[model samples]
Target chain A: MTQYAFYFNGKRCTGCKTCELACKDRYDLTPEISYRKVFEYGGGDWTKDADGFYVPDVFTYYVSVACNHCDDPACTKVCPTGAMHKDADGGLVLVDADRCIGCGYCHMACPYNAPKVDREKGHTVKCDGCAERVAAGQKPICVEACPLRALDFGTKEEMEQAHGDSQVADIAPLPQKEYTHPNLYVDPCKHAQMANEATGKVANILEVM
Target chain B: MDGMLTAFDEITLVLFTTLAPAGALAYVLVALPLIVSGDRLLEEARRRLDRFLCVPVVVAMIGLVASATHLGNPANALYVITGFGRSPLSNEVVCGSVFLSAAGIFWLTSFSEGPGRIGVRGVVVAIISVLGLVFVGVISLAYDASTILTWNTPYTPLTTWLNALSGGPLLAILTMRLARFYTAGHKLGRALVALAALALVASVIVYGLWGSLLPELRNSLASAAELAPLFMPSIGLFALLGIAALVLGFKAATWHGEAPLWLPITSTVLMLVAIFLMRFQFYMIHMTVGVGV
Candidate 1:
């Protein structure tokens, strides 16, 4: 399958949340539910290398996140009926409403905390990667709306080629493990130091399903 | 102290939270009618209707009692109806109340002028009584969660429905057996008793084995692991008792030509004890979302 990746540049990101707004608008979300979320954090260490010019060492970055559309989706394994599925090209997990019994199994199973139940619809909502738009030679809504071009979507190789491998860090944190090894890549600056207790090591970005 | 009274342990809390209404439906509406039917020993429709109505009416009132034991705020419960269209909880509140009222009115009608025993009003009321029980099964499915892979799966809702069928009917049969004393014209009681026992066996085996099997059990992120072993009976013991009930039930059916009623009555009593045990385990086995700790 032609796995895709969401390439992000932490250095360039201003944390404006344009990608978040774009994704929410694209999904037609109700209030209190968002498909993409931007998290902001500040880091500084007053490195000894620089002179006494008082360079603020605080580093802040915006992490824009949606479903990685993994190679091994935890959500599908737990669905009693085959309501959740992966698209053939990049394997974006999709929910089939016809078979869904409104059981809420998928919502509980996704470790990324990706799925949400639409109480009004009596089913669930999730990220589909804007598959319909991608198929029609249009960029994902979030990707198109990124004023800084921080959110880039394309074939994994095409994305890696354009942005280089240094961008995405590695490994999505899971409660247990995603047998469906997801396609999403994260390039965390401290990726080498972060350890997910469940996986017992740093997140492995290079794992392909 | 209210603390001890209200301080239900997690599994006990979950069980009472659910079973008070659930058990009330059995004790008040379903089993109660059967009990009244046994006491009156009425074959005629009118008397049966009057007796049957007693249960649903009583069950509706007992719902209040059981709900009090739940220990959630009474005021917040008013919003319980807000989720009506989608939530089984809402449906249960609606159906249970409506059925109770109708059952009460049916019982209140004396039928001095009617030719038939129960007549159309009796039949309609009885059918409604049974239908209300069916919706109770739906309301049982309303324990929604995002991640508790085993119980949130489709199998969970199906098993809930089965538990109601098996557990409720078994209680009814036992109540009738205790009341009827194997009197003449107790064939209907015998058949119902046997049916309830059989359904309990089928459902318990299917649910415990295939429904909540080891794969799902292992995958569960739940608080249940700590509590399940404290309450759940050994699988081997439950199985032996189940098999014994089936064998004794069939033998009595075959040898006596008529169910001695006592034989089934005894079996139903055993079944209730066993089904209640399973209910305890059911609460203990459930996985709360993201609450694996």
Candidate 2:
């Protein structure tokens, strides 16, 4: 069971969104559709100390999220037609475009919001972890497109061996990691926990699309 | 919160959901009592049931059309039942097909002209009537998926059942009245109105309880927190309309002389509108875990 996973070094990401662009271009997606979504999770405020000096607490970081290709994918579980499914070889999640009825149930079931119904194609579409490229021993387009060298993808063991020390990917604005066992590893920034602490809000929602 | 709904929660899906359950319950509730009404009211009840059995079948057909419209490729819809053992959506399709088929068969057989065959028709109708109830149960359970936190509650199925029980009799009595089966001072008509009223009141209570407890569910999004204000007013309107319809219907059914057709017609129309509004609200509040809020 060679499970594929994504590793994101939140400390290095500049939120430039090259990964998002690469995915859209590769898929030739419509404006409303994108296989990859880069969420900018950030929020904080300046505060006055007892000395009456203004202290800046504001922070921001990028979470370039696409399909996790999770260990227990909810999308596949709820898909009536078995269209949103896992790749047999590498265990990456993928959509069988021909079989999709475009009911959007997979879209609804996915906690990662991975699958999107392409109305023009009349089928649900999502990232397939670049299964063909991966099979050929090449990185996914999103990984290769990152300028910050922040994103990585490989077998779960390789990702864990390289960056497993960041135990909990439980960043707010994103859900609890336990929900889906998302094959996503995050080297969360120092202020990343503020998404849960200060407001429990996703800050750069407007910037993400 | 902005991504609470995709293109899925559109008008066609809403109408499909509303009409399917309503139509199934109409057949089950209306026909069940008639099949068991004994010799006293049996002849009159059979006559009324026969005349009206086609109504739910037609409604079910409209629901089938509405459901097809929700599909991106309806040409592939016949294959939907292929995943029946694992998928609730597939199971819903299977149940809907069985219900429509059984109802259609029963409708055709019920039209036989001979009085001697009425006994056989009653037996066939009773079996199909019970199967109709099973369809309602399946319809209720279909939406109880774990992914959509707002819809995954036990209360989700409960609400469907309550809607069917309450709305079914209203539709039934209206159908009877439309066919001139509402004889002056019929106890069964008044009883149906009373039953509908009680079920409607219970539905309101269940709805209230479901709303209050929703925030407590695990993994649920806070998106629904703001939606309460949006939903409460419409639900209140539904309750008011439902109560008014039942009251007016009761008054009309128990009236000593020939009851005015306008009263039951108005009441039934109001109730249908209320149910439609409630279902619209249902679709509007579809928030799943993690992503939506």
Candidate 3:
């Protein structure tokens, strides 16, 4: 029962969205659905000094996110049909398409906005951690496609061992880590804000949604 | 802006929540006379009321069908029972099914043997009434997910029950008129009107308090204020329609003779529309604790 995890180096990501496009291409997703999303979060206003000189205080950063496969997923908790469940073998959250009624409860409960109800598919769809690739001893398509090597994937113990335990998961534009205890680890960049900070906003809302 | 899209995407659900609870309560209210004092009513009046029970039952069925259409795959709906007692939605579905089944059985039985014995019929109606109230409560709990800040409050269930109370009596009055039960100037009719009036005023106060709480509910993706910009105006319209409906209900209850058929009918429609408006706003203000826009 080894839990898999995703590691993101925020400092290396340039918000190019290559990972997003790569996952879309791999999954052949429609325009409305994306397994991965890159959010551009930015905020801060200018302040005037005593000398009447205006000073800028704006900051911005990119947060590439997909399903974190949290230990306490809100989506799985609210699903009426038990269609969404966390796999016991890989500790990966997966949807059983045969049982899904596509009520959108998963979509509404997920804090990361990962799962979506595809009306054409007649069920909710989301990232399943690229289980096939992992089975073949290869990384996810998005991780392999990241030119800057910002994204990594491995067992949760390995990720925490390699990138110290302290930076496991916490960043702005995401909820408090205590809420879901996401498996995704992060190496925050200079402009990164804590999860509790309310000053910043998701700047590229149109692109993300 | 995203909230509006989310709301529009769930338009069928909005309609379901608006109609189902009120319809369930209406059925209970219409049956209250039979359950409480069936022996006192003339046999002809009892038969007429029993026959007209189909009206509220049909309204509830329409709501259930509307909810089924919201499912992406209706074929898998039966699997929902697997999550019963575990998921709030599953509990809601199960409760609604039980209530509808009881109501359907009672309605079917009324057609045979001239409304059956008074004692037996009264007991069955009492059971259905209890199921109906439980169904409404389950519906309210369906949206009480902790992840949804806008809906995870006492006000959610409070307002839901109040909405059912405010709209249910009018629908029952309409059903009574259709059956020619002649409730005008009766104690029961006056009590219903008074109950509706009280619920309407309480609904207004609760909604106002809920609206005030919305400003503080925010996340990185959106705020409740941004999600529901027209909250005040929507409530204003609700109040106007509610007052109008109350006025019509009062007039019909206190009328000197048999009230005009159009009076209760119009009042019921107005109240249902008002409830629908609030349900629409409920969807519009959907804000998650994080990026779940």
Global lDDT scores for all candidate models? 0.51, 0.73, 0.88
TM-score, per-candidate, Cα-based: 0.49, 0.90, 0.97
lDDT of 1 by residue, B95-131 (tens): 5556666656655664455544434544565566565
User: Per-candidate DockQ versus the true complex?
Assistant: 0.05, 0.49, 0.83
Worst 10 residues of 3 chain B by lDDT: B181-190
Tell me the tens digit of each residue's lDDT in model 3 across B197-286.
Answer: 899999989989988887788888778988888887888999999999988987776677778978988898898899888888898888
Taking the true A–B contacts (Cα pairs closer than 8 Å), what share appears in each candidate? Answer: 0.04, 0.44, 0.77
For every candidate, C-alpha RMSD to the true structure in Å: 13.0, 3.0, 1.4
Q: Which stretches of candidate 3 lie over 4 Å from their true place?
A: none
Ordered by lDDT, highest first, the candidates read 3, 2, 1
Best by TM-score: 3
lDDT (C-alpha) at residue B32 in model 3: 86
The true-versus-predicted C-alpha distance at residue B263 of model 3, in Å, is 1.5
**Candidate 3, residues A180-200: lDDT per residue as tens digits?**
789899999988888887588
Model 3 chain A poorest ten-residue lDDT run:
A161-170
